[model samples]
Target chain A: MLSIRNLTADVDGKAILNGLDLEVKPGEVHAIMGPNGSGKSTLAHVLAGRDGYSVSGGEVEFEGQSLLDLEPEERAARGIFLAFQYPVELPGVNNAHFLKEALNAQRRARGESELDSVAFLKLIKEKIAQVSMQPELIKRPVNAGFSGGEKKRNEILQMAVFEPKLAILDETDSGLDIDALRTVSDGVNAIRSPERAIVLVTHYQRLLDYIEPDVVHVLAGGRIVRTGDKALAKELESKGYGWLTGRDEAA
Target chain B: MTTGEQRATDLEKVLRRGQQQLAAGSAADNWLSAVRERGASDVMTMARPDRKQEAWRYTPTSFLDKAEYAPVVEGPFGAIQPADVEELMLGDQQGTCLVFVNGYYAPALSRLAPGQHMPQVAVLSGQLGDVPAQLKAHLDGIAEHHHVFAALNSALMSDGALLYVPRSASVQAPIEILHVSVGLDEPGICHPRHLIVLEEGAQAQVIERYCALGEAVYFTNALVEIILRPGSRLSHERLQEESALAQHLSDLHVRLDEGSRYKHVSATLGGAWSRTDLRLNFAGEGAQADLDGLMLARDKQLNDVHLDIQHTAPGCISRESFKGILDGRGKVVFDGRILVAQDAQQTDASLSNHNLMLSRSAEVDTKPQLEIYADDVKCSHGTTVGELDHNMLFYLRSRGIPSARARQMLCQGFAEEILDRIENPALHGRATRLLTERLMTYSE
Candidate 1:
């Protein structure tokens, strides 16, 4: 479903992702594990078409089409979603209003009729329950004065509503408590399907326990060093990334 | 005479053209006649404010120098339709209504509430049915003192709305005053005066609106004075929507006594050049004041807002916030000052002025000042001028919304805060619709 061939990118002229390569097929879930500053978030940004990232070398393709040539909104309309680790708070913009606009925009792009407020509200009510978020929060401004856990749950809610073809979660579990972690995991697990692919980028293997991945890849020095089955996650959790690399401490 | 002296004399000669005509001509023995005479003399000597003055530093005075103005002699309430006035009226609002056309009272269009003992509502030239004898004592008490515009408005003062709520009375319904200006053969001027007095423990809500009926060059100079006695509460909303060729100027002065509260919201949405000068004075202890303003300027329009707040007693609180959104080479100026007196200990005050520029040529000059003499007071003043947030733009785009639509949504949200501050639902909804329509048609 996706392919990255010797992809190299830089932020502010400093190389972050150097010669990174990866492949994922439909109906597969891949977990990428890396230590701090291992270019985990950089890979996610490159795929999502965020600005300020320069692609120095190589190419990325999705379904036989070059992904780097598309704009951020264009990629989003094509069913590519990126759940930001730190969702931006927009003051005075209602969450429900923003989500309805987003959903209708994607529908219009797909040559479908737009949903009115009554119909959109009915559909969003169901998704709101799936993510276990208070309906009142949806009426308030988008993530303004929201707690960290609520922000993560709101991201998951968007993922469920969007139903993207490829979902990329970047450090989404960093600021969640145990209860919030389980609720977020449940939300993610419920959205898993055979026709969709998801990429999980994290430093801990605890999330792997709730939503198990079909494959695990070790990322070090901005490249995928090793690829193995689910057992590889447990090995890395026990020995840490320092055990795989020869360094005394993990970056 | 020297050149400078000759020029000054010529300016004074021009300023006295309309000083002798009084719309509601009263007895010479009446106190109002003396005020008019004083105001006219003041205008003759005191020069019009220029850019060199600190208060008028950022606002241009070239527009005021274009043509000579004469008093608008109530031109026969010509071709004005009630439907037009109805369209501008607050939807389904139940209140006492007073309609004026070119500063003349329109009896057929005005409606008086059906209450025998409520507040007195009448035109300045009509009988004051239930008003107290002290009404004259409070007139011109706290205007933009010594300003040429205020003096000019006082010099040609005509019929206006007079509302006075007695002591301990609660006026449940709001008082609505609509000043409609229609075009004339040549450029004309109208001066509308208003006086609102809420006695001790009295409460009321008032809405004063200024609108234009045609696209012709005219001048509207209005004055509003409000006094809140001990333990009184008042909410005042002023909306100005004139034609693109019209120039509107207004001065608002509010005085709060012990344990009183006053809330004010002013919006300047139309006109070629618009200015609303506001002054608020906290006279007694434990008083609270709130001043909120919004301005939308487009198409070479210029909107200037100046606010001055004074805290004279201890344990007083005041908050002032003004916002502007300018597009299409529009210009806006905001100068806000808050002063805490020496004995006003434990006073709390905050002032904020925010501006958003939608075009590179759009101009916004904002200055927020705080002058504090009391050591135990808490005061803060801040000013911000910038474009839309990049993160907010990217977030909306990442959700598949177009860039233009995303910006529109953000701009609407930015302006929605002021509208939401209005407590009246009907007024809030109407302003929201108006603002939304403007935002839809506006583009950078």
Candidate 2:
């Protein structure tokens, strides 16, 4: 479903994703794990087409179209979704209104008729229940004054609503308690289908227990060092990344 | 001559014209005549507002040099139709609308609700022959006439709306004062002075709206004085939407007695050059006042708001929040000051001014000042001038919304923070609609 070849990106003239390559197919889940400053988040951002990150050398193909040249909205219209690590707080933008506008925008871009308010409310209510988010939260401003767990759940709600072809979860498990982790995992697991691909970017193996991955890749020096199965996650958790990168565990 | 000297000369010419108009419409009442004479003399002697003065530093006075304004004595009231006034009426008003075209009361377009409990509503021009003692006492007394524009308004005051609520009467419907400035053949100016008085234990809501009819060079110098007696409450909303070729200047003075409450919302959405000077004075203890303002300036328009809040009695509280959205090369100035007298113990006051610049060239000068002379008082002031958050923009765009729509949504959100403060649903909806339409035209 997604392919990246020789993705060499820079942020402010400093290399982040250096010669990185990854591939994922439909109906599969991939886990990209790395230490701090290993370009895990940068990979997700680059895929989402965020500004200020100059892609010096990259050939990211989604389905069959080149993704590098598309704007963020264009990418979104093509069913690419990035669940932010830290969700932004829109002070005065209502969550439900924003979600409806976003859904309609994507629908309009695909030449589909937009959903009316009644239809949107019904759809959003069902999705909110799937993610176990309070219905009133959507009535308030988007993520404003929301708790950390609530923010993550809100992002999952958005992902469920969008139903993107490819979903990139960047550090979605961080700052979540055991209960929130299970809820988020359940939400993600429910949306797993043969036509959708999910990529989980994390720093720990805890999330893998709830939502098992088809493959795990260890990112070191901005490149994939190892690709293994679910058991590799446990092994790395027991033995820190020091063994994989030949550096101190604390570092 | 330098620019200042030229401006001074232009102001003198305008004042001289205003004096002649006042004499032509001479009133038999000596009190009003004396007031007009004093105001005219004050304008003659007072130094014309120049950049050298602190108050007029950011506000450009070159517009005054554009023409020697002809006082609007006899307006073409017949030119305005009922439908024209109907289009501008607020949805929630209780048909107590007084329409003024070119500073003259349009009786055909005006309506007063038939109710025994309704407040006394009259036109200033109609009552000038037999000026009521109560009206004369609070007309020029409420607002300080030291301001040059206020003095100018008093000097050439032609017509306005007067609202009087008796003691313990809670007015059910909002009183709507719609001031319509119709473009004439020459550069015209109108001074409409509004006086609203609420007796003890009275409650009322008033909406003062200023709208223009044509795209002509006109000036609207308006003054609204509000007096709240003990245990009284008033909610006032001022909406200024003038023509592109028009200049608007207004002064709003409010006096709060003991245990009174005042809520004010001012929205300046359209004008070439607009300035509003608002003052709130706490005369008795346990009074509270809340002020919220929103200004949108684009396409070289200049919008300025100066707020002065004084706490003279103990146990008084005041809160002020003002926001501005500027695009193009537009400029906005926010100067808010709060003062707590020495005897005003336990005063709680806070002021905040925030500006969002949509263009690189748009400018904002925000100054929030607090002068606390009381030993035991809580006072704070803050100001912020910033551009739209890029992260917020990115987050919106990443959700399939276009970049331009995302920016518009964000700017609307920034304005919604203040528009939400309008408790009246109809007025709030109108303001939101106007702002949304204005923000859509903004260039990315």
Residue-pair clashes per candidate: 0, 0
Candidate 1 residues A108-177, lDDT tens each? Answer: 9888899999999898999999989988989988889889999989989998898988999998888889
Give the number of the best model, judged by lDDT: 2
Top candidate by TM-score: 2
lDDT, candidate 2, at B389: 94
Best by DockQ: 2
Which tens-of-lDDT digit does each residue in B84-186 have in candidate 2? 7666777756658888888888888777787733577766776423545676677777767756778888777767888888899998878888888887766
* Poorly placed runs, candidate 2 (over 4 Å): B1-9, B19-31, B127-133
**DockQ, all candidates in order:** 0.65, 0.80
Supply candidate 2's per-residue lDDT for A127. 96
TM-score of each: 0.92, 0.96
Per-residue alpha-carbon lDDT of candidate 1 for residues B33-100, written as tens digits (9 for 90 to 100):
66777777878778778878987887766765665555677647845768877777777767888888
